[model samples]
Target: MADPVSVDVPHKLGREAARARIAGGVGKLADMFPGGGTVEEHWEGDTLHFTLSAMGQKVASRLEVFEHHVHAEVDLPPMLTLFAGKIREKLAKEAPKLLE
Candidate 1:
């Protein structure tokens, strides 16, 4: 295992709205991964954080929505080095789609 990679994404909505979008995005991820693990949600001020854990490995991500944009961070698991790029691409495509 190696150090985790952090990914930040931006959303165009408020905290609550971003949270909802994140929930849906996570659900999409769960479906995409299937039995991979679990997704957890958290809140801090206007930021919505999500953590995904599975097979003893975990990925911590965050979504923050400001007045004009939303910021998101996705931490890559060390074990996922090989598939990290693919996973990021998939998430990038799916996350925004879920918000819609």
Candidate 2:
């Protein structure tokens, strides 16, 4: 895989509140995808682990929640490497809202 893209999204809600908000907003994101997809999510202590598979591409991500920030690491499939910038931009824009 290409080097994983890392994004640090800051939130003012504090870790617990931010974690709750992110978890609740995930279902809304499912409806925004162009085509239907499967998202499998789990938690490892305070970190959230997720795998999103759609249109033959898979993105595995881990979000580490902290008091004032959430650090996200996304592993994009090789085929999707070229779109990394767009993907990062989208995440950079949306992550904060999700955490809020």
Candidate 3:
């Protein structure tokens, strides 16, 4: 089995706001990629746990919201690096719009 490749991406948003935005984004992604996977969200204190899985593979994202920003760490399959890259690109482009 391959080790999961992790990527950390930070977003500029408050804790609650970041959780809302990430949940919405995950919903959008699920809608766009139906049957591709399942997305789950949960919060423990200030940390938000988000996960997507399919075909025995999983992508996990942990969001830690600080006073000034939200730090997100995404772990995915090594073979799916391109897909992850695309997600990062999309998030970089669309997150600000969603936050606004």
Candidate 4:
């Protein structure tokens, strides 16, 4: 395991709307990745737990949905550390659309 690539992506759509958007866009979300991994989501209270696996690596994240923003902490495997910056950059660029 490596230090996680954490991000807080703000969304104008409140918590409920954000959650609905995420839940409904699971397939589109998967397609964002090169290999299109499987997505499994579980909720604990207001936090959404997500696991995306592909090419033997798993990215686990906890999304805390708030009234005006969504906070996410992502744990990336050690092997993927080298691409952390690129991954974070891509996520930052794509997050707004995903949350909308």
Candidate 5:
């Protein structure tokens, strides 16, 4: 938990709409990681709990859907903290396209 990297992806879709799109987009997330790693996802109310394991690292994340935006937080292990900024950037850049 090296200061969880988080990003807010703005969207016009309401909470429910955003949640639906996110739920459906979970599978595609694997593509974002090399080796198409394992991704386990579960929805808890308005938040999505995710765990991705790839290249000997485990990345946990949460996405909370709101009326105007979806907030994403990723917990990278110490070994991956060095790339936190890049991860945040990629998420910020790609989430909007996923929702659209």
Candidate 6:
């Protein structure tokens, strides 16, 4: 268990537009990893709750699409925590593209 990794990407798109763009790309979240994985996605109002399981690690994440930004919080396993900074950095860089 490790602390959650939080990343935010600012966007000019409003909530509806941002949400639509994010919804379309979220299905491919698993593909970003090497071995790929299954994602169980659930939505609660404006927030997306997703669990990614791959290579014996389960990463539970919450993503919220706001009017001005998208925010993500990933709960990584201990093994993955070592790379949390890198993961946060990458997410911050790529999330905005999804909104566009």
Q: Pick the candidate with the highest TM-score.
A: 5
The positional error of residue 75 in candidate 6, measured at the CA in angstroms, is: 0.3
Better of 4 and 5 by lDDT: 5
Give the Cα error of residue 20 in candidate 1, in Å: 3.7
Give Cα distance to truth, residue 26, candidate 4, Å.
Answer: 2.8
**Candidate 6 TM-score over all chains jointly:** 0.89
Model 6 lDDT per residue over 8-46, tens place: 888888999888887888877776543448888988999
Q: After superposition, how far is residue 49 of candidate 1 from its true place, in Å?
A: 2.0
In the range 1-100, model 3's lDDT, one tens digit per residue, is 3333333445566667766775566555433221347778788887778777744566666766665565555665665665665656655554454344
Per-model CA lDDT versus the true structure: 0.61, 0.76, 0.58, 0.75, 0.83, 0.81
lDDT, residue 85, model 3: 58
Q: Where in model 6 is the C-alpha error above 4 Å?
A: none
Give lDDT tens digits, candidate 1, residues 1-97: 5544344555667557766765656655554332357777777876767677655676776766665555555666666676667666666666666
Deviating ranges (above 4 Å) for candidate 4: none
**Residue 48 displacement in candidate 4 (angstroms):** 1.2
TM-score of 5: 0.92
Candidate 4, position 78, lDDT: 78
When summed lDDT is taken over every stretch of 10 residues in candidate 5, the lowest stretch is: 27-36
Query: Candidate 5, residues 16-42: lDDT per residue as tens digits?
Result: 988989888887776665444888999
Better of 3 and 6 by TM-score: 6
Q: After superposition, how far is residue 43 of candidate 3 from its true place, in Å?
A: 0.7
Question: What's the lDDT of the predicted structure labeled candidate 6?
Answer: 0.81
Q: Can you tell me which runs of candidate 2 are displaced by over 4 Å?
A: 29-36
Top candidate when judged by lDDT against the true structure: 5
Model 2 C-alpha lDDT per residue in residues 1-100, reported as the tens digit of each score: 6998788988888988988998887654433223427778998888989888745777787889999899988787887778678667777877777865
CA shift at 56, candidate 3, in angstroms? 6.6
TM-score of model 1 relative to the true fold? 0.66
Ranking of all candidate structures by their TM-score, best first = 5, 6, 2, 4, 1, 3
Per-model TM against the reference: 0.66, 0.88, 0.60, 0.86, 0.92, 0.89
Residue-level error in angstroms, candidate 5, position 56: 1.2
